[model samples]
Target: MEEDSMDYTVFLEAKQLRKQAEDDAKLLSNRLALLRMEEQKALKKIEETRRKAQEIMEARIRNQELLKEKEEKERLKQEEERLKLLEIQNTKAQDRMQREQRVEGCKAKNRYEAKELKEKMQENLEIAERKKQEELEIKTNMKNQIKTQKSLAQEKRRLMNEAKKAQAREELERRIREQEQIRRNYEDSVSRMEQEELELIQRLQNTQLMQQSVYEDLEEAMRS
Candidate 1:
């Protein structure tokens, strides 16, 4: 009866262990599912950020191209105006050359006008160069922004991976501890059972010896 009770208790413990294992498995599965969902969300966010960056880059390129086209048109227009002015000055100089007294004055006027036109052209070139530099800086800033976004995404992924690793490690440690405890409990129960059996055997041997001594004493008394 005692052995049967011990077997029943062991059965209960085994059942409980199985239930605990199932529960732990379920919990791990839930955690994994949640992590996967979060990973998907992070991936989605990264993709969206990339898409926006790509769109912004393309828009900026288009704007830059348009700006270049507008500047080129303006430059051509200025060149045309300068050529017209030069032609007008050449015609007036030719007319003044036909009159000796006025020739020097016309020559002076032409030199001044030429100097002014040259200064205007130089200023326009400087302005164009400044605009080009600004555009370059803007492009550089956009690239840096894209790079920063990429770095952030990578960091987030790295953190997620680390979190998963930590969780897995913790679960492994917990299972190991539980298994060790179960082993210890089993060993203790076995040791206790062995001790009890040894004690019972010793008691039985003592009881048999006492009975034999009593019988011998009875037999001797009858003979007398």
Candidate 2:
């Protein structure tokens, strides 16, 4: 009867130890499952970061292309303006040459008329003086027109330079902003990855400790 009682007690103790081991195993399995889930989440986050980085790079490339295109347009516009100024200068030069030729012809005709009208010297003198006055007026008008065109051209050049400076400032500011944003994003990704790695390491350490404790408990039960 005593032996039977001892056997029954031993059996009960063995059954209880088995139940505890089973519970511990189930808990460890659950922890491993949770760790796998966390790992999956970390991987997903890493992939998302990579995608964002790729998008940012593409955007930067596009911005560079746009900048180049704008610069080309500005260059073309400047060239066109230069050509227009040249044309205007050429036209002015032609008009001046024509006016000088007309004045010389008039002078020659006046000389012939004076020689033919020696008896009407006073009348010829008056006509010659009027012609000289008309020539002087034409010269004065031509000088004024040239001065006005020069001033207008200078003003146009100044305006173009100011516009170019403004555009350069804006472009520089935009590039700075983009670089700052990229830097922030990179730092954030690195920080997040480090945090996730630390968490995974800590979870693995905890699992190792739990396994060690379970092994110790099993060993102790066997000894008992």
Candidate 3:
């Protein structure tokens, strides 16, 4: 009976050791499963972060493209405005030049008319002087031919009649006065025309200066 009790004690010790080892193995397996689950969750979080970063980068690139496009549109609009302004300035300058040319032409025409008038007046004066000289020569020849009293008396009577009839000197003086009046009138007209032309040129210059000032203001505004 002693030997049998010893054997039974040994058997009981062995069985308890086996049961403890099995419980330890079960705990280790559970810990390993939990660690795997945590690793998977971390991997998923990393993938989500990476995807968000990629989306943000793409959005930034798209925004940059949009900004570039907007800038290009603004530049084109400014260029168009500049071209329009240039065209306006060129047109105004052309109009001013044409007006100046017309003013010069008018001045030339006035000068030509005045010259023609002067020449006509001088020609008339010369003709009147020539006729008076011819009449004086004839009168002197007739006076030399008187040789008798009767002839002299007849010549005197003729001379008296001619003196009463001939108003050449008066007519000549009247024509001279008329020529002087015409010259004065022409000079007055020329003065008036010149004054009017000067006023017109001044007005044109003032308008040009105003337009230039306006253009400069527009340029300043655009720059600002």
* Candidate 3: segments with Cα more than 4 A from true spot: 1-9, 55-224
Off by over 4 Å in 1: 1-9, 58-224
lDDT of each: 0.69, 0.70, 0.67
Error of 3 at 64 (Å): 13
Whole-model lDDT, model 1: 0.69
- lDDT for each residue of candidate 2 in 38-98, tens digit (9 for 90 to 100): 6666555555555555665687789999989999999999999999999998999999999
- On residues 107-209, what C-alpha lDDT tens digit does candidate 3 reach at each position? 9999999999999999999999999999999998777766566677988988888886457545544555555555555555555555655555555556555
TM-score for each of the candidates: 0.23, 0.24, 0.22
The TM-score measured for candidate 1 stands at 0.23
Write the residue-wise lDDT of candidate 1 on 44-79 in tens digits. 555555555566568778988998999999999999
